[model samples]
Target chain A: MRPAEADGGARPVKEVRAFIASRGRAPASLLDRYVAGFGLVMGAAVVGRPIASLLGGLAGATDPSRAGAGTALVLLACAGYLALARAAGPVSVSGGDASWLLLSPLDRRGVLARPARLLLAVAVAAGLLLGLGLAAVLGAPDHLVWRLLAALVVGVSATLGGMALAVLAQASASWQSWVTAGVAVLVVLALVAASGQARPALSAAAHAPPAVLGAAAGAAALACGLLVRRALAALGRIPARALLAASTRAGHVATAAVRLDPGALTWIAEDNHWRARRLRSRRWPSLPGPLALAWQDWLRLARRPGRLALVAGAAALPAVLAQAGAVSATAALGMVGVLAGALAAASSGTAGARRDGDNPSLARLTGVGRGPALAARALLPALLAAAWAAAAFAGLALTGTLPATSWLWGPAVAPALAAGALRMARRGPVDHSMPIIDTPGGAIPTGPLFWALTGLDVALIGCLPAVAALLGGRMGDGSLMAAQALAGVAVLAAYVLRARRAR
Target chain B: MYESIITVTGLTVELGGNPVLTGTRLAVAAGEIVAVVGPNGSGKSTLLRCLAGLQPAGEGTIEVFGAAPSDEGPFWRRVALLADEPAWYPGLTAREHLELMSAVHTGPSRLTVEDALDVFDLRSRADAPPLNLSTGQRQRLALAATLLRPSDLLLLDEPERGLDAAFRERLAGLLDAYAAEGGTVVMATHDPLLAAHGRQVSPATGGVPA
Candidate 1:
């Protein structure tokens, strides 16, 4: 055993970290400290007004009709947070630390302490947001301060417990199953809440006395503390190989972020998922050349049934939001959310196009003409976007946010969404050399900005008719739908034709 | 007499103000195999890229199929280039990748997916994703994908990379069989066994036959 392992590893690990830190770059100068402090102050100043306004909005009694949907939304958001935390390897070090320290004979818990603290900080911030959102949604009928505090306590406890559960899941398979079950339960509960079956309970909780609320918060906090203790103990038991794999994934994510290349993140996730999966080879379906080439995307989408179900489930989110009075307040926000969700759904089917764009050796080997291949590729995304947007629109219309015929807008704009998704997939890495223009607020780096807007630009331009009609409450108009369909088809055809001429 | 499939004369490539290949000359005919052997940074891959019309030569004339090579669909239909391992499509098994290759071509594949898996000794792991395979296995999968499709000419860069001695020899025979089927191959190789299977040339010596 190494020397560090002799005396429980903690002291040695600290000494080593300090030694490395001392040998590292100079400490921040006074000016650097000043700038950081000034930035924080300015940020707080900018965020303060909106937060105050939001708090003011939380003063009234909860709207009974909106209570169930609001509660469901809150539950769904928490579930999403937990899932993201689990996926991110809630306990992971930076690439440098992972390389140098992770495999050493230090106390595993000691090595993980910094990352654990970082996770805590992130969880706390997210919990605060969740708390604020809950307070705003459920409303404080009286004694706003005490109710808000209770809500904050409950939110923090829930996220802290969820985060602790995620950490435990990393160390134990049994815990992983529990986390999965928990997320499933949350989703089911959300559906129940959205259906208005939970209104009585939600209404009672919203108007509960401060003493009862405090007791519930106390129970939650106790559970959170126990889970956290278990998680801290479990840290030492996490396998080295698992930690290494998670660290490598985190390194790739960091690299992608540093490069401002969001597209690379999808590939990283894709490759990681497949690397761990066991798959049986299936015979390729007989199809024409370009269609055969495009069939991989279809096969890929079919393979991930859970993801498809999640996408299907998310179609109800717009209606839920509208019922919660969030989307109904802003028509533009509602339309944007629908379009964005459709584009994301479309993007899920464009992995094959993305792979070819990154490295076209397979594409070249296939030897399919670009136009025909692209046209074939567009079919799946267009179909996916069409279905997703239509479902979302139907939900919104049922919620009285849109007209009865509003679902027609979904298919009309789907081709453009598909075109946008394909464009996004093929948009290569961000070019950092693009000019940065100075603005009053800050210097705007056009490189990443343009990279981000590349696909959205096409989608927005193509879906302009739909956007205008939705905003104008003209979804019942037949002419606008016809115009949107024409525009969508034109955009997709133009994109494919241009791609054919490229290279 | 065999028809000439490719001819290059006075080929020069400069990258970032440095010459990688200077005054290179090469000629290949149908059913011929030429191995371009050179040290690292000797522009072997660059020469292959030029042949595929992917790299722009600073000064040279490269004629493939009696026309300047073009990086377009029709040109690729007649030529297959396997340099670095292509990014395998996610969620695809090794056999599935070969199947995709066979499915996407109108012409008959040289080897069926099952035959390729058996020949490449990947039958056991054929159902696994290429990412999960060992480096040599992934290389074999790439080769399977490359050769399974129909092409008149093959450009292979370091085809022996990540292969064991036994597999390398088998690959040499496979290339011979490919050439025997009235196709042309120009590969860059570090393995003497693979190089000796073809007319050995070096980019250092302007790609002249050695």
Candidate 2:
């Protein structure tokens, strides 16, 4: 607790409490809370009974394969959580709080304590949920209540430990470096599990003796408390400017996530790229400015080898699924089309979005109009998506999964979709909601029309050829090709027209 | 009228392992306008942040209104700060943001949302989203929101940034007027017109020169 004299006996923390208390409880017009509560109750009732029955049925049915699968799944989820925590540490504050309250003469820990505790509680709840699910799946529901409690303790331990590492990374470069190393170790463990070399070890840990597990849980809780205390102490010493920067970056990540902007991830990676030396003197060939701009965009993607790997991996998913008989070749190709469409949506907006988001003034210095500049910017992403689509098509063809003629869809729709997405992204990241339409129960959100337009492009590019072939067969293949080509050309024309109008 | 409201001694601060303000010292009195002038990368903004208790001192101390600023201290309730760069929540409308500032302020504020909007010449764009506003409008909105509430100490870091010459003059007058009302004003700027409104303090080698 902060001393009263910290604020010259005025007790700023107490004032904050008073401010909150003065607002009273929920407002009279907060019907949304009831609506949300009703939804939650309905969701639980809908989902709970069946899940309970399934767990009851699976109890005491200890199949080694199921246990192995459950262990692998839990480990993968933990890895994902750890990686995410490493990338974007624990704390989140609005820009308003950073500017106003962060500089205020209030106990920093007192202000941060509630939010931090809430976040930690959420993490513990999530862990409990995951652990219970895993325990049920692994056939440890004999003494179900006790088993669940044990699992909860372990889950809380793991979550807090991960959080502690993440927060420690903020103050220590060495801890930050350990994050990548931890990821590498997780990858290795996953590889070992896949090879069946680590299944016994995982299964043993899953079914450890109750006494041993309890002791481990106690030790973990103690460690977690110490880590939380250390992190809060370290946080007090951290520069406010650093917190502000972190808050801004977190805001960008949140925005990118909400918008489902794939390019945003690339933007984050680009922003955080660690270079040995600043590329101050690096120069490109003095070709025409448009070409130079296009080259720069391409070079950015090229330098980030990880992004290229992701593109190739995404492009290969459909073919792999087809090869494994997970879906039909036509369905596989359509799935690939969806992936390509999403990639187009993400990569297409890269250059223009970066310009608009970070440096609009730099964009203005080009001396060119929006149309030409955007058109030039569109080229690199389009070509890249086309290459990815082509690679996917080749993989499908090589594996004898699809006819050679189906390859035509890749070259045509990929670039067209890319161009369309580029135009949509160049409109800027402003939220433009359409009017709400009246429904029987209430008004339904019309949502962002930009996303609807992007979805239309996806349907045109990803589903058009697939739907045409399903109805037409080999006899109608030529006609379907012509239709796809024409549709692609139309989309391209619309993109060009929009670009011209943008200026 | 001139009562020392802020005092700093041997204030050293580091950012990203590099010392920005080494052994800096300063004093500012009530009803005074002090311009912190320095070239880019100089510790002008840093000194102001230290005074406002935004940045932690690596060594030495800072006193605001005869007491050090901390999260549990009333010292912040008497201070208002405006940073050069705008930091706005994307979901908020300009009007809603002003309303939020008014609501969150610990002390009494004479300015309403309408007053702030009209004063900042943003009445027409009050309902518009922040992302819709231009760079200059965003800067003005930040300033308006910060200045909405009355405060004893006003810290403005490069307030002239992103503003036109006309707005710059208006800002100078605003600072002078605030000073005349017995408020302390410390602004970081390179604009000579704005600097001329206050006693110039060059912050070249970490500490401000007398």
Candidate 3:
């Protein structure tokens, strides 16, 4: 055997074997990470559980068992969703040392068994912890041991089943539709029914007697095991070359003709992807700069859905709490909408910039004929802020809270946010090694993207005084307000464009 | 004398038709670690980026490793860059950084980022987040990760900015050793002592080729 062939030097192999091997030697590192994860989970549970409990109390502190089942379903559903998302259509066994092991002395199925085998450790630990928690909660320490242990197994199985089904279901277009349909059904049930009434449909067994709960958990776990096997089976069928090629996001887009001026920040943003594409110059940062990146960022931000929903609630909360039924709901919501827009814009500005590392060098490698990428960086947030603020305003306007005379100021607030955000958008402290998080479940890109969005929110807040004056009809009416907003956005967009070009 | 691995002809960089670099030209061959030195805003990094096919020349031609600096030259795969504080996912560990890179690489082999870390002396705190590490540690980690990949043309922007003396010496030796293996390197630096390792080309305007 060649020495070079056997020696993997300088850089560790990114293969599953190498990754797993690193875990063993770096005992402290992995353990520390797990500890951190544990701390995070516990901390979140501690802080979050009480708030959830309080909210449930407001609806009626009805049933702890029901609440537990509901919480489990929600948590497990999110995990399932992530598993499906990661599967990306599930043609093969992805994780563990399958590829390298298959090539080694091990049999195919045996090689694939490592990731599958790790489930026991997971089940044992999770079961013990959960069992302890459940026993403590119910004051049933005598049955706690068996109950929690069984619950852990059941939980794992349920998640695994959901994950497997999600992976397979994702192959069909209707799966997303089905999930959407189910979520809609759940949401409706939540809004209309009493607390936890919808939970039983999904996790009823956990709410039943001790024996029933244990059995339910075990059965759920068994289903999850089946899912793991199905995923494994589906995985073994994929072509190796196809997997390898797909794994590396390498392709040259010959038709990807994007031109931007030299030495511009637009050029910088485009150039980053150029670095990302090691072997293919055919693909690069689109000539339009960060515009494409911005839209994508926007789409992902929208997917959270929580952002918009929160704004709606913020606006709605004010009106709902209002004593005047005539003025109760929508009116207060509008004022809050205006205020919330300001808050959102302020916070979102610094998203992608995260100090300053998102600066010149990080972006200096893409196409640079048109400043579209930079334009997108500036515009998408502005548009998104505008859309969001507008939605907030729409809610308020519907509620009869927004002064009709001043309503024109809503869109104008967007430009104000973008302008202020761009000024603050200048890079801060620099980080040398932040890899882009491609998936939402992966670490979110927390720099200029967030900052940009927040900046837009700031503009919304900044424009409020003017919005009030215009809406009140004391200053200018709709036309004057609209013109002012347009001018402001134009000015902000221009400043952002100019600054990026200089960069 | 060495055969030229890089050459630039009539290169000019412009913004909105205003010249940042007008009629810029340079050339260097194999087994050379040429330092493109200049004061701030002298277009030193721009020239390297153009040569690396990172930034397009407004008016010029470039070649690397006998091939023009096209975006996807074999030279690129064989090249690496130590950018000035590049972006990173704050959540990723150093090992994850190399893992991700190796995952996307095109080769029949493995790349171990650990040795590069060892060379930079970052093995102990490898799993530590770069954001929490000292500036020097982060820089070394970035440089180590880049060096982990095989490259012949290396375009570094102040690659030794935050390093201590030992790491600096190690870097110069690493460059020297690579040149010993017929690799060509172009770097931008502010240190005159380290600049002595290579023939110093003033990256600023108003300098004629030696």
Compare the candidates by DockQ and give the number of the best one.
1
Instruction: Report how far off residue A5 is in candidate 1 (Å).
Output: 7.8
- Over A196-238, each residue of candidate 1 has an lDDT whose tens digit, in order, gives 9988888898999989998998998999999999999999998
Q: Which ten residues in a row have the lowest lDDT in candidate 3 chain B?
A: B102-111
Candidate 1 CAPRI classification by DockQ? high
TM-score quality measure for candidate 3: 0.39
Query: Candidate 2 on A242-333: residue-level lDDT in tens?
Result: 56767777777777777755446555554455222122212344454445444445545555567567566566555544443434554634
Question: How displaced is residue A174 in candidate 1, in Å?
Answer: 2.9
Which consecutive 10 residues in model 1 chain A have the weakest lDDT in total? A326-335
Computed on alpha carbons, the lDDT of every model, listed in order, comes to 0.90, 0.63, 0.52
Candidate 3 local Cα displacement, residue A340, angstroms = 8.9
TM-score per prediction, in order, is 0.97, 0.55, 0.39
For all predictions in the order shown, the interface RMSD in Å is 0.7, 20.2, 11.7
Worst 10 residues of 2 chain B by lDDT: B84-93
TM-score of chain B of each: 0.98, 0.89, 0.86
What's the lDDT for candidate 2? 0.63
All candidates in order of DockQ, best leading: 1, 3, 2
